[model samples]
Target: MTMSKTRSEGSLPVVSLPLPVDVTAPAVARQAVRATLGGLGLDGPEVDDVLLATSELVTNAFEHGEKPDRLEVEYSDGRLTLRVFDSGTSRPKLKEPSPMAARSRGLQLVHALSDDWGHELCSGGKYVWAVFSLARADASA
Candidate 1:
Protein backbone atom coordinates (compact mmCIF):
# COMPACT_ATOMS: atom_id res chain seq x y z
CA MET A 1 0.00 0.00 0.00
CA THR A 2 1.13 3.55 -0.81
CA MET A 3 -0.31 6.76 0.66
CA SER A 4 0.09 10.39 -0.33
CA LYS A 5 -1.48 13.66 0.73
CA THR A 6 -3.68 15.15 -1.92
CA ARG A 7 -5.26 18.53 -2.55
CA SER A 8 -7.31 19.74 0.37
CA GLU A 9 -11.07 19.91 0.24
CA GLY A 10 -11.95 23.09 2.09
CA SER A 11 -9.84 22.87 5.28
CA LEU A 12 -9.76 19.07 5.52
CA PRO A 13 -6.97 16.99 3.99
CA VAL A 14 -7.41 14.24 1.43
CA VAL A 15 -5.38 11.07 1.21
CA SER A 16 -5.44 8.40 -1.47
CA LEU A 17 -3.74 5.05 -1.83
CA PRO A 18 -3.19 2.40 -4.46
CA LEU A 19 -3.29 -0.99 -2.82
CA PRO A 20 -2.31 -4.41 -4.01
CA VAL A 21 -4.71 -7.13 -5.01
CA ASP A 22 -4.18 -9.84 -2.41
CA VAL A 23 -5.65 -11.52 0.64
CA THR A 24 -4.03 -8.97 2.94
CA ALA A 25 -5.80 -6.04 1.31
CA PRO A 26 -8.37 -5.66 4.06
CA ALA A 27 -5.80 -5.57 6.86
CA VAL A 28 -3.64 -3.10 4.95
CA ALA A 29 -6.65 -0.90 4.33
CA ARG A 30 -7.69 -0.89 7.98
CA GLN A 31 -4.28 0.28 9.09
CA ALA A 32 -4.13 3.10 6.57
CA VAL A 33 -7.63 4.17 7.52
CA ARG A 34 -6.79 4.33 11.20
CA ALA A 35 -3.73 6.48 10.61
CA THR A 36 -5.49 8.88 8.28
CA LEU A 37 -8.48 9.35 10.54
CA GLY A 38 -6.34 9.67 13.63
CA GLY A 39 -4.13 12.25 11.94
CA LEU A 40 -7.23 14.29 11.24
CA GLY A 41 -8.21 14.30 14.94
CA LEU A 42 -11.23 12.09 14.43
CA ASP A 43 -11.91 9.37 16.97
CA GLY A 44 -14.53 7.21 18.64
CA PRO A 45 -17.56 5.89 16.75
CA GLU A 46 -16.65 7.80 13.60
CA VAL A 47 -13.40 5.91 13.36
CA ASP A 48 -15.04 2.59 14.18
CA ASP A 49 -17.73 2.98 11.55
CA VAL A 50 -15.22 3.92 8.83
CA LEU A 51 -12.96 1.03 9.73
CA LEU A 52 -15.80 -1.45 9.57
CA ALA A 53 -17.07 -0.05 6.31
CA THR A 54 -13.57 -0.12 4.79
CA SER A 55 -13.17 -3.76 5.73
CA GLU A 56 -16.48 -4.63 4.15
CA LEU A 57 -15.57 -2.90 0.90
CA VAL A 58 -12.16 -4.54 0.68
CA THR A 59 -13.45 -7.95 1.72
CA ASN A 60 -16.28 -7.80 -0.76
CA ALA A 61 -13.78 -7.07 -3.52
CA PHE A 62 -11.66 -10.05 -2.57
CA GLU A 63 -14.56 -12.46 -2.30
CA HIS A 64 -17.06 -11.26 -4.90
CA GLY A 65 -15.42 -8.79 -7.26
CA GLU A 66 -12.31 -8.96 -9.38
CA LYS A 67 -8.81 -7.92 -8.40
CA PRO A 68 -8.89 -4.90 -6.09
CA ASP A 69 -6.87 -1.94 -7.27
CA ARG A 70 -7.10 1.26 -5.27
CA LEU A 71 -8.59 2.98 -2.22
CA GLU A 72 -9.29 6.69 -1.98
CA VAL A 73 -9.99 8.01 1.52
CA GLU A 74 -10.86 11.54 2.36
CA TYR A 75 -12.11 13.62 5.29
CA SER A 76 -13.83 16.81 4.33
CA ASP A 77 -16.19 19.18 6.00
CA GLY A 78 -17.44 16.78 8.78
CA ARG A 79 -17.69 13.64 6.72
CA LEU A 80 -15.53 10.73 5.58
CA THR A 81 -15.55 9.12 2.14
CA LEU A 82 -14.06 5.76 1.21
CA ARG A 83 -13.92 4.36 -2.28
CA VAL A 84 -12.65 0.95 -3.35
CA PHE A 85 -12.03 0.27 -7.00
CA ASP A 86 -11.71 -3.17 -8.54
CA SER A 87 -11.33 -4.75 -11.97
CA GLY A 88 -14.58 -6.70 -11.97
CA THR A 89 -17.73 -6.00 -13.94
CA SER A 90 -20.12 -7.17 -11.29
CA ARG A 91 -22.60 -4.62 -9.96
CA PRO A 92 -22.85 -4.27 -6.20
CA LYS A 93 -26.21 -4.81 -4.52
CA LEU A 94 -27.69 -5.96 -1.24
CA LYS A 95 -28.79 -9.57 -0.90
CA GLU A 96 -31.16 -11.41 1.38
CA PRO A 97 -29.08 -14.09 2.98
CA SER A 98 -30.67 -16.85 5.02
CA PRO A 99 -30.39 -16.47 8.75
CA MET A 100 -28.32 -19.61 9.00
CA ALA A 101 -25.90 -18.48 6.35
CA ALA A 102 -22.37 -17.89 7.51
CA ARG A 103 -21.73 -14.87 5.26
CA SER A 104 -23.07 -12.35 2.71
CA ARG A 105 -23.91 -9.32 4.82
CA GLY A 106 -20.97 -7.07 3.98
CA LEU A 107 -22.91 -4.52 1.99
CA GLN A 108 -25.82 -4.72 4.37
CA LEU A 109 -23.64 -3.67 7.27
CA VAL A 110 -22.20 -0.84 5.19
CA HIS A 111 -25.67 0.34 4.26
CA ALA A 112 -26.78 0.28 7.86
CA LEU A 113 -23.72 1.96 9.33
CA SER A 114 -22.87 4.59 6.76
CA ASP A 115 -24.92 7.74 6.39
CA ASP A 116 -24.93 6.83 2.68
CA TRP A 117 -23.41 4.11 0.50
CA GLY A 118 -23.38 3.28 -3.20
CA HIS A 119 -21.34 1.93 -6.09
CA GLU A 120 -20.41 3.40 -9.43
CA LEU A 121 -19.54 1.62 -12.66
CA CYS A 122 -16.29 2.81 -14.13
CA SER A 123 -14.63 2.21 -17.47
CA GLY A 124 -12.77 -0.93 -16.41
CA GLY A 125 -14.91 -2.14 -13.53
CA LYS A 126 -16.68 -0.71 -10.50
CA TYR A 127 -15.93 1.37 -7.43
CA VAL A 128 -17.84 1.02 -4.19
CA TRP A 129 -18.09 3.99 -1.87
CA ALA A 130 -19.47 4.93 1.54
CA VAL A 131 -19.77 8.21 3.42
CA PHE A 132 -19.79 8.69 7.19
CA SER A 133 -20.67 11.86 9.03
CA LEU A 134 -18.25 12.92 11.75
CA ALA A 135 -19.09 16.39 12.85
CA ARG A 136 -16.76 17.88 15.47
CA ALA A 137 -19.33 17.38 18.21
CA ASP A 138 -19.74 13.72 17.28
CA ALA A 139 -16.06 12.96 16.85
CA SER A 140 -15.21 13.94 20.40
CA ALA A 141 -17.69 11.42 21.73
Candidate 2:
Protein backbone atom coordinates (compact mmCIF):
# COMPACT_ATOMS: atom_id res chain seq x y z
CA MET A 1 0.00 0.00 0.00
CA THR A 2 1.15 3.56 -0.76
CA MET A 3 0.35 6.98 0.67
CA SER A 4 -0.45 8.76 -2.54
CA LYS A 5 -4.17 8.12 -2.41
CA THR A 6 -6.47 10.11 -0.18
CA ARG A 7 -9.51 8.42 1.30
CA SER A 8 -12.97 9.51 0.18
CA GLU A 9 -15.03 11.86 2.34
CA GLY A 10 -16.19 10.40 5.64
CA SER A 11 -14.20 7.42 4.58
CA LEU A 12 -11.00 7.40 6.61
CA PRO A 13 -7.53 8.77 6.29
CA VAL A 14 -5.46 6.15 4.53
CA VAL A 15 -1.81 5.52 5.28
CA SER A 16 -0.15 2.69 3.46
CA LEU A 17 3.00 0.73 4.09
CA PRO A 18 4.52 -1.15 1.19
CA LEU A 19 7.16 -3.35 2.73
CA PRO A 20 8.83 -6.59 1.86
CA VAL A 21 7.46 -9.72 3.47
CA ASP A 22 10.42 -10.81 5.48
CA VAL A 23 10.97 -12.28 8.93
CA THR A 24 11.99 -8.99 10.49
CA ALA A 25 9.67 -6.92 8.34
CA PRO A 26 6.58 -7.72 10.38
CA ALA A 27 8.22 -6.69 13.61
CA VAL A 28 9.52 -3.54 12.03
CA ALA A 29 6.13 -2.86 10.54
CA ARG A 30 4.52 -3.28 13.91
CA GLN A 31 6.87 -0.69 15.32
CA ALA A 32 6.10 1.71 12.51
CA VAL A 33 2.39 1.29 13.19
CA ARG A 34 2.92 1.99 16.86
CA ALA A 35 4.84 5.14 16.12
CA THR A 36 2.22 6.39 13.71
CA LEU A 37 -0.86 5.63 15.81
CA GLY A 38 0.72 6.52 19.11
CA GLY A 39 1.42 9.98 17.86
CA LEU A 40 -2.33 10.42 17.57
CA GLY A 41 -2.48 9.92 21.38
CA LEU A 42 -3.54 6.27 21.56
CA ASP A 43 -2.67 4.73 24.91
CA GLY A 44 -0.47 1.76 25.68
CA PRO A 45 -2.99 -1.06 25.88
CA GLU A 46 -4.69 -0.06 22.65
CA VAL A 47 -1.42 0.20 20.83
CA ASP A 48 -0.38 -3.16 22.18
CA ASP A 49 -3.64 -4.71 21.12
CA VAL A 50 -3.30 -3.49 17.54
CA LEU A 51 0.33 -4.45 17.50
CA LEU A 52 -0.50 -7.95 18.67
CA ALA A 53 -3.26 -8.23 16.11
CA THR A 54 -0.99 -7.13 13.31
CA SER A 55 1.73 -9.42 14.49
CA GLU A 56 -0.65 -12.34 14.44
CA LEU A 57 -1.85 -11.53 10.94
CA VAL A 58 1.63 -11.00 9.57
CA THR A 59 2.82 -14.20 11.12
CA ASN A 60 0.02 -16.01 9.37
CA ALA A 61 0.93 -14.42 6.08
CA PHE A 62 4.50 -15.51 6.51
CA GLU A 63 3.55 -18.96 7.69
CA HIS A 64 0.70 -19.71 5.31
CA GLY A 65 0.08 -16.92 2.78
CA GLU A 66 2.61 -16.67 0.00
CA LYS A 67 5.44 -14.29 0.85
CA PRO A 68 4.50 -11.51 -1.44
CA ASP A 69 6.75 -8.47 -1.71
CA ARG A 70 4.61 -6.25 0.42
CA LEU A 71 2.15 -6.00 3.27
CA GLU A 72 -0.38 -3.16 2.94
CA VAL A 73 -1.59 -1.54 6.15
CA GLU A 74 -4.23 1.15 5.60
CA TYR A 75 -4.73 3.43 8.58
CA SER A 76 -7.47 5.95 8.41
CA ASP A 77 -9.14 8.31 10.87
CA GLY A 78 -11.13 5.87 12.97
CA ARG A 79 -10.16 2.44 11.71
CA LEU A 80 -6.97 0.53 11.15
CA THR A 81 -6.85 -1.90 8.24
CA LEU A 82 -4.40 -4.67 7.46
CA ARG A 83 -3.90 -6.03 3.99
CA VAL A 84 -1.40 -8.78 3.32
CA PHE A 85 -0.75 -9.98 -0.18
CA ASP A 86 -0.12 -13.50 -1.38
CA SER A 87 0.17 -15.19 -4.77
CA GLY A 88 -3.21 -16.86 -4.65
CA THR A 89 -6.47 -16.11 -2.90
CA SER A 90 -6.44 -18.61 -0.10
CA ARG A 91 -9.25 -18.37 2.39
CA PRO A 92 -7.62 -19.28 5.66
CA LYS A 93 -9.69 -20.96 8.29
CA LEU A 94 -9.16 -21.59 11.92
CA LYS A 95 -8.88 -25.33 12.33
CA GLU A 96 -9.29 -26.97 15.67
CA PRO A 97 -5.82 -28.24 15.89
CA SER A 98 -4.79 -31.01 18.20
CA PRO A 99 -5.52 -29.42 21.57
CA MET A 100 -1.82 -29.30 22.02
CA ALA A 101 -0.84 -27.98 18.66
CA ALA A 102 1.87 -25.41 19.12
CA ARG A 103 1.30 -23.24 16.06
CA SER A 104 -2.34 -22.57 15.33
CA ARG A 105 -3.08 -19.44 17.32
CA GLY A 106 -3.05 -16.91 14.49
CA LEU A 107 -6.67 -16.66 13.39
CA GLN A 108 -7.95 -17.39 16.86
CA LEU A 109 -6.15 -14.40 18.27
CA VAL A 110 -7.17 -12.16 15.37
CA HIS A 111 -10.83 -13.13 15.69
CA ALA A 112 -10.76 -12.24 19.32
CA LEU A 113 -9.29 -8.79 18.83
CA SER A 114 -10.31 -7.30 15.51
CA ASP A 115 -13.78 -5.76 15.23
CA ASP A 116 -14.04 -7.21 11.72
CA TRP A 117 -11.76 -9.04 9.32
CA GLY A 118 -11.93 -10.80 5.97
CA HIS A 119 -10.28 -11.25 2.58
CA GLU A 120 -10.50 -9.88 -0.95
CA LEU A 121 -9.42 -11.53 -4.17
CA CYS A 122 -7.53 -9.14 -6.41
CA SER A 123 -6.33 -9.37 -9.97
CA GLY A 124 -3.14 -11.20 -9.17
CA GLY A 125 -3.33 -12.26 -5.56
CA LYS A 126 -5.29 -11.74 -2.36
CA TYR A 127 -5.53 -9.25 0.50
CA VAL A 128 -6.55 -10.39 3.97
CA TRP A 129 -7.53 -7.59 6.28
CA ALA A 130 -8.85 -6.63 9.70
CA VAL A 131 -10.25 -3.35 10.93
CA PHE A 132 -10.17 -2.11 14.50
CA SER A 133 -12.09 0.89 15.75
CA LEU A 134 -10.05 3.80 17.03
CA ALA A 135 -12.83 4.94 19.32
CA ARG A 136 -12.44 1.87 21.47
CA ALA A 137 -8.74 2.32 21.39
CA ASP A 138 -9.01 5.93 22.51
CA ALA A 139 -11.47 5.14 25.25
CA SER A 140 -9.28 2.36 26.54
CA ALA A 141 -6.28 4.59 26.32
Candidate 1 lDDT over residue span 1-141, tens digit each: 579877788877678777777889999999999988877777777688889999999999888888898888877878789999898988887998789999999999999899998999998899999999886645548
Please name the candidate that would achieve the greatest lDDT relative to the true structure. Answer: 1
Off by over 4 Å in 2: 1-12, 75-77, 136-141
Model 2, residue 119: displacement in angstroms?
0.8
In the range 29-90, model 2's lDDT, one tens digit per residue, is 68767765766555556667788887887777777877654555565566767776666668
RMSD values for the candidates in order, in angstroms, are 2.2, 3.4
User: What is the lDDT of every predicted structure here?
Assistant: 0.87, 0.69
List candidate 1 segments past 4 Å from native.
137-141
Q: Distance from true position, residue 51, model 2, in Å?
A: 0.5
